[model samples]
Target: MRETLLLLGARRLQVPAIHVARKMGIRVVAIDPSPDAPGLALADCGYVYDLADKKQCLDIAERERVNGVMTLAADFPTPMAAFIAQQLKLPGISPRTALLSTNKRHMRAALSDANVPCPISISARSLDEAIHAMKSIGGPVIFKPAVSQGGRGITRLEPEESLNSIKSAYEHASNATRGDGILVEEFVDGPEYSVEALTWDGLTTVVAVTEKLTSGYPHYVEIGHSQPPTCSTYDVEQLSRTASSGVAALGIDWSASHSEIRLTCMGPRVMEIGARLGGGYINTHLVPLSTNVDIVGAAIEIALGRKPKIEISLKNKAAAIRFLVAKPGIIQSISGIEDVKNLTSFNDIDIFVNPGDRVLPLSDADGRLGYVICTGENSKSAIEAAETAKSLISIKTV
Candidate 1:
C-alpha cells in the first residue's frame, strides 16, 4: 500500500489530513512521541518516535517508501518534515525555508531583509539579555520562544510592569523551550488577522482571511476566529498582498502556509508565519464551511505534487469557532453541550476532554477543552451564534 507519513500525529490539525488521506485511498503512517496521540487510532499504521529526531523520521519514511511526509499545525516539526522529504526525494519545501519558518528570529530576519513588512525582532539566550533587549526595544513588547508554537511561552510585557516580573516571564518562556533562546519584538498594537494560503510552484493563492479574537490582557490565548474577516475590503486586500509577499520571501514552494498579521497604523505587520496548516481546525472545518474550500484536501494534493483546485463555492456567509476554557484544576464534569446543540444558532460542538480529566487554565493550545463551531449568513450573526454556543456550555471543576 502507498503510504503517507504524518508527523506529530497527536495534533488536532493532523486529524483532518489523516481523514482526507484515508478517504483518498492513501494509507497513513502516523508518527509521534506520545503513544496516546488521538490520530493514532485512525492511522493505517502508527509508529511512536520523537518528531524532532529527523533521522528516525527519515528512516521510517524510507522504510515505508512513503509518498509524502508532512505535518499539520506544528512548526517545530517542519524541519523534520523537510528532512524526510529531502532524504526520500519526495515533494516538499526546501530545508532552508523550512528552518526559516520554524525559527521566528530567522523568519523575521529573512522577511525583513527581503523588505517584507514584519516586526523588528531580537534574540536572547538568557533572561538578562532579554531584559536589556526589551529596554532597547522600548516597553510594551512581546516576548516568545524563538522556535515555539501554539502561543506557548508568549508574554506581553507592559511598561508599567516591574522589571523583575518581566525577567521572570522571559525566564519562564525560555525554560519552556527545547532550546534556551527567546525572541523579543516590538508589540504591534492593532487588530490581528490570519491569512491562509497555499503555494504552488512559488505562486501563492489566498484561501481565506480569518479574523482572530483573543483575550486582550495578560494572556494572548485565542478565544475565537471568524472567516471572511470583518475588516474592510482595503484591509483584506492589504493582508492578502502582504501574506503573498511574505510567503514568497520565505521561498516556500508547493506547501500550505498559515500567517498571522496585525493591521498596524504603519501598515500590516506580520506577527508570525507557519509553513503548515492552521491549528484549531481553522483550515479543516472553518475554512471549508465558510469559503467552500477544501483546505485539507488541497494540502494533501500540494504535498503530492498536484495543483490544488481552489474555488469559492460558499459565499456571503460566515463561520466561527470558540474554544471552551476553564480555571486551572481537575475537571469534574461538563454539561450544556446537548443544550448548546439544541440552540437555533448551533451548528457543531466538539468536546476534547472527558470527566475526571485534569484541565488547565487557558494559556496555550493544550488548555482548550473543546470548541463550538457556528455558522450564519453574516459575520456578526456567526460570531453571535458562536458566543451563544459558548455560553451554553458550562465546565465544572473540583
Candidate 2:
C-alpha cells in the first residue's frame, strides 16, 4: 500500500509536486481555498479549504491519516506544513523554524545570532520607530513587511526621499503584514542571487545558484531568473556557506530551503530564507533543465522519509524564465504567442490575462501578464531565447 501525503496549496506551482508524488506511487491529498486549483485534478483527494487554516487542514489530515505533509513555492503553506507535521508526528521542519523563516525580523535575528552575514536591520512598529530606524540604519535602505511575499509592499528609501515617503511606506508594510510591524535594512549594493539547497539528517546539499533579475526602485518585482548563476567559484562557495548557516540557524532539517543573498564587496549577505523551494518556476523548471535534478521529486521523497539520491546528472546547461509586463490598461489584443512557441528553446508560455482583462502596472507579482520558460546550451543562449520569444509576443492596450 502506498503511503499518503497531505499536500498544502493547490496552485499551478503545486502541480509539479503532485505529479512527482503520483509518479512515485504516493497517494496525494491536496488542500486549497481555490475550488479550481489546477493541482486538485491530479490528487487522489483534494479539500477546498484555505491552506493557512490550521483547523481545516488538520481535520482533513486526521481523516486521511496521511504519512507525510509538504508544500513548495507557496509561503502561506510553509508554517502550516510544519504545523500539520508536528500534529501528525511526520518528517518536516519544526513549527518554530517555519515561523521564523516567514517573519523578517525573527529570521534576521536568528541568522545574525548564528554569525551569518546579513544586512543591518531593525524592526519598527510605529512611524516614530521607523524614523529612528532609518536614521540609525542610514539612508538608501529598504523596508519590507515582517510577513509578506512576492515582493509586495517592499520600498526603497533614498537619502533625498521625503520623511513622509517612509511614513506612507511604513503604513503599506504594516498593511501587508499580518502583524503591525516592518523591518528596515540598509540596502546592500550588488548583484542578487538565490541559493537552492536540500537538507537531510542535518547535512545540507547545495543544489544550484540562480541569478535573479527584478524591477528596480520602490516596488521591486522579480522579472526573470537564470541558472546556474554566472558568478565566480568563490562567490558560489560563499553563498552556499551563508545559506547553509542560515538553514542551520533556522533548525531546518529534512527540508528544502530557498535563500536569497546579495553579494556585496564584503561577501554574500543573506537577505532571507524560505523553508521551501524557490518560486517563479526556479525549482520545478529551471533546476531540472539546468542540472537535470528533479527537485520536486526529491522534496517529495524526503517528505516520505525516503533517502533521495542527490546527484548532478547534467552540467553547463542553462534555463531561464522571463515574465511579460504590460501597461496599466485593458488589453486590446495579444499576438505572436503561437509564433514564439515554435522557437527552438521555448519550453512553455503562460498568458495569465486575456484581451478583455485589465493589466495593472508592475507594482507586485500579481501584475504579471504572462511568462516564457526556455532552456539552452548556455545562460546567454537561454536568456536570448527567452528574450526573443518575449519580443515576438505583443500585448496591445488602449
Quote the lDDT for 56 in model 1.
83
> Each candidate: what lDDT?
0.84, 0.88
Model 2, position 92: C-alpha lDDT score: 92
Candidate 1 lDDT trough over 10 residues, lowest sum = 3-12
**lDDT, model 2, position 146:** 89
* TM-score for predicted model 2 compared with the true structure: 0.97
| Model number with the top lDDT | 2
The 10-residue segment of model 2 with minimum total lDDT is: 307-316
List the pairs of residues colliding in candidate 1.
none
lDDT of 2 by residue, 1-398 (tens): 78999899989878888888889899999998999999887899988997778898999999999998889788878999999899988899999999889888899989989999999999999888888888887768888898988888888888567878978888878888877389888998788999999888788999899998888887878899998788888888889988998999999987999999999998888888999998898999899889888888888878877778988755547998999998789999999998988998999899988999888778778788889988899888999898898888899998
Per-candidate TM-score against the hidden true structure: 0.95, 0.97
Tens-digit per-residue lDDT, 99-191, candidate 1? 888888789999998898977688898877887888788868888888788778878888677878887788767865666499888888889
Candidate 1 residue spans exceeding 4 A from truth: 1-8, 314-316
Candidate 2, residue 194: lDDT: 95
- The numbered model that scores best in TM-score is 2
